[model samples]
Target: MKLIIGLGNPGKNYDRTRHNIGFMCIDALAEKWNVTLSESKFKGMYTVVHRPEGKVMLLKPLTYMNLSGECVRPIMDYFDIDVEDIIVIYDDLDLETGKLRLRQKGSAGGHNGIKSLIQHIGTQEFKRIRVGISRPPAGMKVPDYVLSKFSKEEEPVIEQAIEKVVQACEASLSKKFIDVMNEFN
Candidate 1:
C-alpha cells in the first residue's frame, strides 16, 4: 500500500492559504479518485482507495503544521507502512511560485512540518513533493506570507500547479517514483 500525506493546518481559515497547498492538492486528488477522506484515525482524515496498481491511503494530518508527525507516525505504524512507500506533499518557500521539486530524500530546509515529520519518522530519506509558494516579499514576515491567501494574479498559476501535483501523484501509483520525479520535477 502507498501512504500519501499532505501537511497543513486543519481549519477553514487555513483554506487556500499558501501554507495549505498540500491539503489543497490532496483534496483535488480525492475528488479525482472518487474517494472522500471520511475516516478519522491518529488525528488525520483519510480514506483507502483500491486502485488497479494497489491500495492507496490519502491522508491530511489534523495536528496542524508544527506537530504533524504526532499524527503521521502512528498511522504509519498502525498500517505497517514502510518509509519507502510513503510520499509527503508540502509547501516550499525557496522556489518560484507554482513550481514543484520532487526528491527521494532531503533536509526539511526550515519547514516546521517537514522537520516534525523527519524527527518523528526518524529518517530524511522519505519521498517528498515540495510545492513552491515563493519567498516572502521585502519586509514581510515568513509566517504572515505563508498564512496569507494568494493574490488575484497568482490564483491561476497556483491552480495549475495543484493540478500538476495531482497528476504527478497519480503517475507515481503506477510508475517508479524516480520516473515520476523525472517527469514532473
Candidate 2:
C-alpha cells in the first residue's frame, strides 16, 4: 500500500488556516476518489482507496503539525512501506504563492512538521510535495501570519494551487518523482 500523508493541525479552529492547506489537499483527494478517512489509528485520520493502479492510503496526521512524525512511523512500520512509497504534502514558506516543488529528499528547510518527521524516521529520503504559502509581509510575526486564514482575494489562487498539487501527487504515484517535478515544479 502507498501512504500519502498530509501534515496539519487538527480541530475546527485550524481548519481553514494557511497552515492547514496540506489537510485541505488530502481532503480534496479523498473526495475525488470517493473515500472516507474513517480509520483512527497511528494518531491520524486515513482511508484506503482502490485506484486503478492499486490501493492508496490517504493520511492526515493527528499529532497536530510539530509532532507529526510519531503518527507516521508506526504506520510505516506496520505496512512495511519504504521511504520511496511515501509522500508528504505540506506548506512551504520559502516558495512563492501558487508555486509547487517536488523533491525526492531534502532538509526540512525550517518546517517544524518535516523536521520532526526527519528526526523520527532517521532519514530525509522520503518524497515531499511542498505548496507555497509565501513568507509574511515585513513586520508580521511568522507564526501569527501562518496561523491566519487567507484573505478572500487569495482563496481562488489557493484553490488552483491545491488542484495542481493533487494532480502532481497522482502523477507521482504512477509516473515517478522526476516526472512530477518536470510537470508541476
Candidate 3:
C-alpha cells in the first residue's frame, strides 16, 4: 500500500491560503476519485482508495503544518509502509507559482512541515511533490505570505497546479516514482 500525505493546517481558516495548497490538492484528489476523507485517526483524516495497481491511503495531517510528522509516523508504523511507498505533497516558496517539483529525497529547504516530517520519520528517503507558491514580496514576512490567500491573478495558476497534483497522484498508483517525476515534475 502507498501512503500519500498532503501536509497542511486543518480548519476553514486556513482554506485557500498558500500554506494550505497541500490540503487543496488532497481535496481535489478526493473529489476526482470519489473518496471521502471522513475517517479520523493517527492525528489526521484519511481514506483508502483501491486502484488497479495497489491500495493508496490518502491522508491530511490535522497536526498542523509544523508538527506534521507526528501524524505521519504513526500511520506509517501502523500500516507497515516503507519510506519508498510514501509520497508527500506540499507547497514550496522557491519555485514560481503553479510550478511543481518532484524529488526522491532531500532537505526540507526551510519548510517547517517537511522539517518535522524528516525529523520524526527519521529519514529523508521518501518521495515529495512540491507545488510552488513563490517567495514573499520584499518586506513581507514568509509566515504572513503563506497564510494569505492567493491574489486574483494567482488563483488560476494555483488551481491548475492542484489539478496536476491530482494527475500525479493517479499516475503514482501504477508507475514508478521516477516515472511520475519525469512526467509531472
Candidate 4:
C-alpha cells in the first residue's frame, strides 16, 4: 500500500488556513475518490482506498504541524510501509503562492513539520509535494502568517493548485512518481 500524508493541525479553526493546504489537497482527493477519512488512529485521520494499482491510504496527521512526524512514524511502522512508498504534502514558504514543487528527497529547509519528520523517519529521502503558501509579509510573524486565511484574491489560485495536486497524486497511483512529477511539476 502507498501512503499519502498531508500535514496540518486538525480542527475547525485551522480549516482553510494557509498551512492547511496539505489537508485541503487530501480532502480534494477524498472527494474525487468518493472516500471518507472516517477512521482515526495513530494520531491521524485516514482511509484506505482500493484502486486498480493497489491500496492507497490517505492520511491527515492530527498532531498539528510541528509534531507531524510523531503521527507519521507510527502509521508507517504499523502498515509496514517503506519510506519510498510514502508521499508527503505540505505548505512551502519558499515558493510563490499557489505554485507546486515536487522533490524526491531534500532537507527540511527550516520547515518544522519536515524537520520533525526527518527526525522521526531518520531520513530526508522521501517524496514530497510542496504547495507554496509564499512567505509572510514584512513585519508579520511566520506563525501568524501560516495560520492566517487566504484572501479572496488568493482563494481561486490556491483552489487550482489543490486541484493540480490531486491530479498529480492520482497519476502517481498508476504512473511512476517521476512521471507524475514530470507532467505536473
Candidate 5:
C-alpha cells in the first residue's frame, strides 16, 4: 500500500496555522474518502481505504514537524514500504503562496521536517508534495512565521489551496503526479 503522510505540529492552536497546511490537506482527504484519522499508529493518525488499484493508508504524522522522520521510519520499517510508495505533504516557503510542487526525489531544501525524514529514512529517494506557504513577512523570524496562524486576508487563498492539495492527493493516488504538477504548479 502507498503511504501518504502530512507533516505538521499537533495541537488545537496549530489547527489553522501556516505550518499545518499538510495536516489540513490530509484532513480534507480523510473527509472525502469517508476515512477516519482517529486510528492512531505509526507515530501518526491514519485510515485505510480500498481503491480500484489497491488499499492505501492516509497518514498525518504527529511528530510536530522537525522530528517527522522519527515517526515515519518505524512505520516504513514495519510496513516494508518502498521509498517510491511514500509521499509527504508539507509547507514550503520558497514558492509563491498557493503554489504546489511535487518532486520524485531530491534534497530537503532546508525544510527541517523533511530533513529529519531524509536522515531517518537514510535517503531522499521518495516523493514529496510541497505546498507553498510563501516567505514570512519581512522582519519576522522564520519559525515565528510558520507557527503563526493565517491572517484574515490569507484565509480565502489558503482555503482554496487546501482544496487543490486534496485533489493533488487524489491525483497522486491515481498515478497522475505529472498531470497534477502540470495543472497546479
Candidate 6:
C-alpha cells in the first residue's frame, strides 16, 4: 500500500491559503477518485482507495504545519507502511508560483512541515512533490506570506498546479517515483 500525505494546517481558516496548497491537492484527488476523506484518525483525515496497482491511502494531516510529523509517523506505523512507499505533497517557496518539483530525498529547504516529517520519519529518503508558492515579497514575513491567500492573478495558475499534483499522485501508484518526477517535474 502507498501512503500519500498532503501537509497543511486543518480547518476552514486555512482554506485556500498559500500554505494549504497541499490540502488543496488532496481535495482535488479525492474529488477525482470519488472518495471521501470523511474518516478522522491518526490526527488526520484519510480514506483508502483500491487501485489497479494496489491500495492507496490518502491523508491530510490535522496537526498544523509545523507539527505534521506527529500525525504522519503514527499513521504510518499503524499501517505498517515503509518509508519508501510514502509521498508527501506540500508547498515550496523556492520555485515560481504554479511550478512543481519532485525529489526522492533532500533537506527540507526551510519548510517547517517537511522538517518535521524528516525528523519523525528518521530519514529523508521518501518521495516529495513540491508545489511552488513563490517567495514572499520584499519586507513581507514568510509566515504571513504563506498564510495569505493567492492573488486573483495567481488563482488559475494554482488551480492548474493542483491538477498536476493529482495526476502525479495517480502516476505514482503505477510507476516509479523517478518516472513520475520525469513526467511532471
Clashes of each: 0, 0, 0, 0, 0, 0
Query: Model 2 compared with the native: what TM-score?
Result: 0.98
Candidate 5 lDDT, 144-184, residue by residue in tens: 99999888888888888889888777777776666767776
> Which pairs clash (backbone N, Cα, C closer than 3 Å) in model 6?
none
User: What overall lDDT goes with each candidate model?
Assistant: 0.95, 0.90, 0.93, 0.95, 0.86, 0.94
- Measure candidate 2: CA RMSD: 0.8
Tens-digit lDDT string for candidate 3 (69-157): 99999999999999989999999999999999989999999999999999999998899999999999999999999999999999999
**Candidate 5 worst ten-residue window by lDDT:** 175-184
> lDDT (0-100) at residue 109 of candidate 2?
92
Model 2, position 46, has a per-residue lDDT of 91
Candidate 4: regions farther than 4 A off:
none
Tell me the lDDT of model 2 at 3.
89
Least well predicted 10-residue stretch by lDDT in candidate 4: 170-179
Candidate 4 residues 74-114, lDDT tens each?
99999999999999999999999999999899999999999
Model 5 gets an lDDT of 0.86
Considering only N, C-alpha and C atoms within 3 Å, which residue pairs clash in candidate 5? none
Model 2 stretches astray by more than 4 angstroms: none
How do all models score by TM-score?
0.99, 0.98, 0.98, 0.98, 0.94, 0.98
Give the CA lDDT, 0 to 100, for residue 21 in model 5.
Answer: 89
- Per-residue accuracy of model 6 over 32-77 as CA lDDT, tens digit each: 9999998899799999998889999999999999999999999999
lDDT of 6: 0.94
TM-score of structure candidate 6: 0.98
